[model samples]
Target chain A: MATFHFELVSPEKLLFSGEVDAVVAPGAEGVFTVLKDHAPVMTVLKPGVVEIDAAGNKEKLFVRGGFADVGLGGFTILAEYAIPVAELDAAKLDADIKNASEDVADAKGDEARRIAAEKLAQLQELKTALAL
Target chain B: MPSLKDLRNRISSVKATQKITKAMQMVAAAKLRRAQAAAEAARPYAERIEKVLANLAGGVSTGAPVLLSGNGRDETHLLVVATAERGLCGAFNSSIVRLAREHIQRLQGQGKTVKILCVGKKGYDQLRRNYEKNIIELVELRGVRQIGFDQGDAIGRKVIDLFERGEFDVATLFFSRFKSVIQQFPTALQLIPAQISANENEAAAGGALATYEYEPGQDEILATLLPRNISVQIFRALLENAASEQGARMSAMDNATRNAGDMIKKQTTLYNRSRQAIITKELIEIISGAEAL
Candidate 1:
């Protein structure tokens, strides 16, 4: 079996770094997985869950938005916000959803409203996904 | 002449101050380690973003992105001065403020209108003295334990919004760059109408020959990358300021402790000498009295 390096970095700290069996990221277009010898690719990520499998152990994380870089060396996701699935609290998510909705309602123009709505939609999707 | 009681009180007060400064120094030392590590850890992201920017720099048409090409004038300027929230850090805040003051003066001399956006309370307090009217916004991180990207992003968004509104044609960020525990120098970085240094451009051009490709057209990526770059720059500044603040506080407190030690030694010697003088005077008076009897 072959392993590839993976790193998930947020603004506050480096979240995860190790040799992983595979990494599945929620890219803007779709969910994509990376393995050993994966082609170099760079893409922006959407708000969703990222699944990582290493040595028969599975870990999942919720990411707000960010970019993923797949290079010859390894794979890295520069996440805007990332939290482990286990640590995700419903109360905080609810607060975030309320804030996003307020942002949408309080937006001054079309551009601002659209951006806020997108954020709200993402939060809603995350909530629905978590319910399952 | 002062009473012995007064001298003793002053000595005790100085000792109390010394203890406070000593504790602060230790706390600053611990915070410095974490701040320094965070600043160092963020370097890779900064570099990566820069490389991507360099790659896409050539593709963007001149004056396409307002961030990259400016709003066609440099008459109005915005100085984003970042400093520590607290004041025990010796000259750290003052140095950054001084640099910004000079820069503002130069711009004003050139007949440019300058607006100030203070990121920290200390900077706001200092700049408010002279340029109070010119200050547009004050973003204080007083209660925040650690500087995060969200704060940086908010600041960046505010700057961008101001620029979009034609409030300022040029924006410069002022902060203290952390070099070491005892060394931090104030640096001014141009933010609006982002300028790429000659060296960075050359290195980026060299790296362009590599097999990296941008998904979608290069212009599309650059459009989004430029604004995100602003946030990254602001985040870097905040982190650097955090480290510099801790470093400055640590050294400043260290000096305070040492000065208190010196003062204590001098006061103790003076007190002992005065007591000895009083004792000699009393003994001589008693002997003279006995002879008269």
Candidate 2:
């Protein structure tokens, strides 16, 4: 398998930068994967997991609210919040889902309600995917 | 002319002050190390985002987002002044405020209405004396132990909401840029209608020059990215300000400690001289009384 450079960046610091075989990211439209020599593309990211396969080892990280860009420089993900799945706390996830549900119920405007609902859905989806 | 008791008190007070200043200097030095590391770590993300923005901005020539292109009016100005929450940092807060003052004066001179958005308690305290009416909001981070992206995001959201409401025609952010431990530069960056550096565009374009396919569309990506860019810029400013604050405080406390030491030494010398003079006078008196007897 061919490899390309991949970088995962957060506001506080750069999390990961290395040559990777494949990166599967959750895009706003849908989930997509990037491989070596992939065409240049830019997409917004939602709350979900980012799976990285590098040199036969696999890593999964949860990201929320950011963008992914694949260019001549390779692939880069600017995540608003990112943490390894292994380090995630199940109790915190449940609390977040509960809060998000309340926000959805209390939202007044149509746009606000829609955004809150979307957030709730994403959190629920993540909970099921992680099975925690 | 003073008593030995007074001299002793003065010397002791000076020595106590020196101890405090020395402790502060050490604390500042330790904090500066961590702050500098954080500022350096955040650089790559900022640079990468800028590059990505440059690429996207260069591709879109017409129908650009309102954030990339202004509202076509420059009558009103919003200044976002960011300063350290605490004082005792030599001239760090004052310099930023001074720069902001000059900007306000210049804008008012142009027959333009100016609004102030102060980010720290120090800045708000200084600016409110004269421009109290002009200040729209004061965002205090006094309770925060460390600056994070969420703080910046909150400020950015407020600015965007104001812009959307037609509160100001232009928005500028003021902060102290950390060059080194000994040097910090006060800088002003235009936030609304984002300023994309010319060199960045050339550098980004030089690399790929390949057209990018936007997932949804160019407009949608830009609409989201530009807003995020604002938050990123604010986060960078806050981090730089943190490093600069620690640097300034360290140097200031170092000077204070040295001055206190000098004062203590002078007071000790005065005390010794006074005590010796008193002893010599008493011995002379006793000798004179013996001769008379």
Candidate 3:
């Protein structure tokens, strides 16, 4: 299998940087997979799992509120927040869900309420997806 | 002449201060390592974003987002000053505040309305003396053990909200750029109407001939990216400031420890001399008393 450089970076630190066979990222539009020699594209990312395949060793990371830029250099994910799926804290997720629900209740206008409700849904989806 | 006890007490006090300074220096050194690593780790993301932004900005000349294209008037200016939450990092906070002060003075001189947004406790405290009325908000990261993306995002969101509300036409972020352990350069970055250097655009253009296919259209991507870019820039600045703070503190504490050592040496020398003089005087008195007897 051909490999390409894949880097997952958060504001705090670079989570992963190495050669990977493929990267499956959740784009704002939808989930997409990138392979070697992928076209240069820029897309925003939503809160979802990013799966990486390197020599049949698969790894998953959770990312939120960031973007990915695929250039000639490599495929890079600049995530606002990223953590290994194995290391996701259940307590923090629960707290976030609770706060998001409250935000939905407290939101004033239709636009704000819709955004909050969407965030709440996303968190809930993430929770169930992770089965936590 | 001072008594022996007084000299001993003074020497002991100096020694205690020296111990404290030494401990602080060591702690700062350890923290500096972690901070430096964090700052280094964030550089790749910042650099990549800059490159991508430059490319995106190059492609879109007209109808660029307000973040890339100005709101058309520079009547109001916003200064976001980021400093250390705690003082004692030698001139770190003051230097940043000084840069901000100069900026405010310049902007005010231009007959522009200037508003301040302080991101740290020390900056707010220092600028509050004169610019109290101009300070719109203070975001204090007091108890945060480590500066994170969330803190930067909060500040970025606030700035964006203010921009959306037409609070300020121009925004500049003031922070200390960490150069080395002993060198930190106070820098001001214009956030609003984001500045992309010409050379960067040229370089990005020259390097990649491949036309990027922006998902969900170019304007949509720019709208999302420009805002995220603000947050990323603020995040980088915060990380740099954190490293600079630790570096400044390490060097300052090192100097303090050295100064305290010098003081302890001088005090010990004076203390010994005083003790010797006192003992010698007593011996002479006893000898004279014996001779008189």
Candidate 4:
């Protein structure tokens, strides 16, 4: 199978970069997979696992909200937070959920409250995924 | 004239100072390497965001998003000044503060309400001497080993909140742009009323803009993207400042070490001369006493 270039970049570091067989991203509306020669599309990412299948090896990473761009040249993921599923810290994730809930409670307006709620929901989902 | 003993003490003190400075230089050099790597690593993401932004911008009408179009008033200005938490980094902190001060003066002179938001301790310390009332908040990242996106996101959210609440009409961020170890200069970026420069336009035009499609329409994506752009820009600035701070410290320590070496050399010369003069006088006294006997 012909492979194309793909890079997964986070603020902390570049997590993955190489030719991949297929890349699956947890998009806002649904989960989608991209392969070589895919049409260019920009999509928002949700807080979930991004699975990358490179040759025979499979890698899954937990990512916070960010964006994925499938361009003609290659596919790129610009994530706010990206870490291996195994490296996810349960205690810190719990603390983040607590803080986000507080933000929701202290939120002043509808928009702020909605945003905070969305963040809280995402953290809760992550917590559930980890079974923490 | 002072005795040779004093010059000896002075030389020893200078040597000690030189050792300290040399050590600091080495430390800064090591730190600068890490900081530079971090800053460089972040560039691709920042550039990619801008590219995506430019592509989306082409579809939307100008002045549509609140972040992109802005609130359309320049009456109130908030300056987010970023500097180093610690000092001894040459003019790194002072230069940022100086630029911010001048900007503040210019804004205030125009009868505009100017507010200061300081990000680092050194900047707050300098600006407080003159513009204490103008300062709104002082954010100190004192013990943070590495600058993170969370910090940038918080600051960006604060600026957006202030804008949404009608607290400020315009916002500007000040930080040092790191070029090299010997070269770093101050740059002020306007955060609020995000302006798309010509370079960004070209970058998007050169990319695969024609092929990409937005999932939920252009305007909707822009609404969320613009706010994230602010956070990304601030994150880049913080990283640049980190690199610049270390670079400045390295150079400053290097100069101090050289200056200490120079002072030691001058003191050693003086000490030797003084010792030789004292010995000659003693010999003359002994010869005179022998002649008189």
TM-score of each: 0.92, 0.95, 0.93, 0.94
lDDT tens digits, residue span B147-254, model 1: 778899999989988988889999999999999989999999999888765445575567532555555445656676778889889999999999999999999999
Tens digit per residue, CA lDDT, model 4, B1-293: 87777788888999999999999999999999999999988888888788778777766666588788778888999999999999999999999999999999898889999998999999999999999998999988898899988888888898898889899989999999999999998999998888776555685567557667887666777888899999889989999999999999999999999999999888888998989999999999999999999
Candidate 1 TM-score to native: 0.92
Q: Give Cα distance to truth, residue B203, candidate 2, Å.
A: 4.8
Q: Is candidate 3 or candidate 4 better by TM-score?
A: 4
**lDDT scores of the candidates, listed in order:** 0.86, 0.91, 0.88, 0.88
Q: Tell me which residue pairs clash in candidate 1.
A: none
The per-residue C-alpha lDDT of model 4 at residue B265 equals 87
- Over the stretch A19-111, how does candidate 1's per-residue lDDT look in tens digits? 999999988777899999887676777788899999989999988877787777788887878899898888878888898899898888898
The reply for model 3, stretches above 4 Å from the true place, is A99-119, B198-200, B207-210
Each predicted model: what fraction of the native A–B Cα contacts (within 8 Å) does it retain?
Answer: 0.22, 0.87, 0.76, 0.57
Candidate DockQ values, in order, are 0.41, 0.85, 0.74, 0.67
Q: What's the TM for model 2?
A: 0.95
Error of 4 at A96 (Å): 3.4
**Order of candidate numbers by lDDT, starting with the best:** 2, 4, 3, 1
Q: Write the per-residue lDDT of candidate 3 for residues B1-293, one digit (tens) a residue.
A: 77778878887887888798789888888998988888898888888778778888777768888988989999999999999988889999999999999988988898999999999999999999999999999988888988787788889988998998899999999999999989999999999989887645586557573478888788887887888889889988998999999899989989998988888888788888877887999999999999999
Cα lDDT of model 2 by residue, B82-147, tens digit: 999999999999999999999999999999999999999999999999999999999999999888
Highest lDDT, which number? Answer: 2
